[model samples]
Target: MRSTPPPPQLQVVAVVGPTAAGKSDLGVELARRLGGEVVNADSMQLYRGMDIGTAKLAEDERGGVPHHLLDVWDVRETASVAEYQRAARVEIDRLLAAGRLPVLVGGSGLYVRAAVDRMEFPGTDPEVRAALEEELARGGSGPLHERLAAADPAAAAAILPSNGRRIVRALEVIAITGKPFTAQLPGSDEEQSVYRTLQIGVDVARPELDARITTRVDRMWEAGLPDEVRRLEQAGLREGRTASRALGYQQLLAAFSGAYDEETAREETVRTTRRFARRQDTWFRRDGRVHWLSGAAADRAQLPERAWELVRDALGR
Candidate 1:
């Protein structure tokens, strides 16, 4: 008798969308239904002690589904997309080898792409990076962002204006390769993917999304986001280049520094997050591979089932 061989390669499912678009809840629902696990792609959620502001789901909310790569980084460490890519691939591959489906979920567009897409990271020149850092330090992200927009409009549009670290990295890549940062990512050829993937984009109307973002900000403030930031501040959250600039955390840190009041910070969080969500949508929209679903538009209940159909069909393919 012949020995049994391993199963064929598994197709991964990615639930992606803007902030507060019900991606997490849907991801949990899908994972529970499909006997799969959740792999986080949210950049801000990677930091420890960032639950309230990042809106990280509580243990009870996980519905018994295992979530990987949540709270894996210290508050003092700058979040690295490259590092996250490596870790996420490892986790996704492990799940695949275990004969389980990997449900990739989050709003971080670049991190999501880095995990599933075949992209080459250009080498960084220390001097070039240091020079860009100096510029970012001296003038802030506005000037750098303008330059990036001139050099690579797509990259500038995708990255938030306040994300100095990512801006620097993009500029460094541009300087090193003398090419647009977006050029590093190849087209959506089937062979470019690490695995067969079903990219689902949760779509919501603008007015509803804006309202949801406002409500979320209010909830975060009510949940003692200030106190959480205070604790993380003591742990050097402000010192971390990446963590300090997270949406809610950035506003609160400014308030802490006497730049504004806590109320103003909360208001800014809502405003900026809505704008950031638009950028997130724009980023995912540029990826034609995403299958847009309106199940998140108005609390629609058919999202999970409809998504399952797509997943099921993709698996068969």
Candidate 2:
């Protein structure tokens, strides 16, 4: 009798959730079980020395599994979704060629979608980006939001006014490509995906996740997060840019300037993190492909077993 052949290669397994949801541990164990490599998908985790704030998995904590794309960029330099897609595709392909599964893990919904769905965000023109950046720097996000609202009301309705980065990027797309941002969203692309992907989402009740966010923020401060931010500030990396505007850094700035006390800063961090998590949930909920696993039973022992079952069932492995 002949032995059974293994299932065909799937696109990738994407483990996504809000902060403090144990995505990294799950990904590590899943990779160990399935002979997979972990790929970073979080926006903040790519920045060097942003460990505690971004909740990056330490090298030792990775359980000797090869992880890609984490801590590969300077915090001062920003990376776009298109860039992430390109890098992730190369990494994923390499993993497959090595006969290992690629496990993409992070809470950054846009980055995860870019890797899994393989979105084709329009190429950026420096002149167009410069123009939009100038307008945003001079006027602010309000004016840019107004412009986006006028041009693409649907996208404006979906995007928050406070998301200055996205608003400006959308306007840049319209200016550069002469096409609406909503229309450019990647639809079903059956041909491009290398493997049949299993998208796993870890979720908790809003209140519970918010509480976890609060606790985690307090813990970050206790772990010398302010010192980390001060180092970045002294390095001249703090300014009106993408990384500085991250929830952890923004709250710390307030504390450093006496606008808010340390405790208040921690509280604000929790609030902002909760809001960011909510936005992440909203962004990911639209994709019906994700299989949501509750954080209520988020245990080290159970998640791996369950996730393996889900992946095996999905891939017929």
Measured by lDDT, the strongest candidate is 1
lDDT of each: 0.90, 0.81
lDDT of 1 by residue, 153-217 (tens): 98898788888888999999999999999899767767888877889999998998999899999
Candidate 1: count the clashes.
0
Where does model 2 exceed 4 Å of error? 1-9, 188-194, 298-301
Worst 10 residues of 2 by lDDT: 186-195
Residue 30 deviation, candidate 2, in Å? 0.7
Which residue pairs come into collision in candidate 2?
10-195, 10-196, 11-195, 11-196
Clashing residue pairs for model 1:
none
TM-score of each candidate structure, all chains considered together = 0.95, 0.89
User: Per-residue lDDT of 39-96 in model 2, one digit per residue for the tens?
Assistant: 9998888877787888778789999999999877776786678888889989998988
C-alpha RMSD (angstroms) for model 1:
1.9
User: Residue 258 of model 2: what lDDT?
Assistant: 83
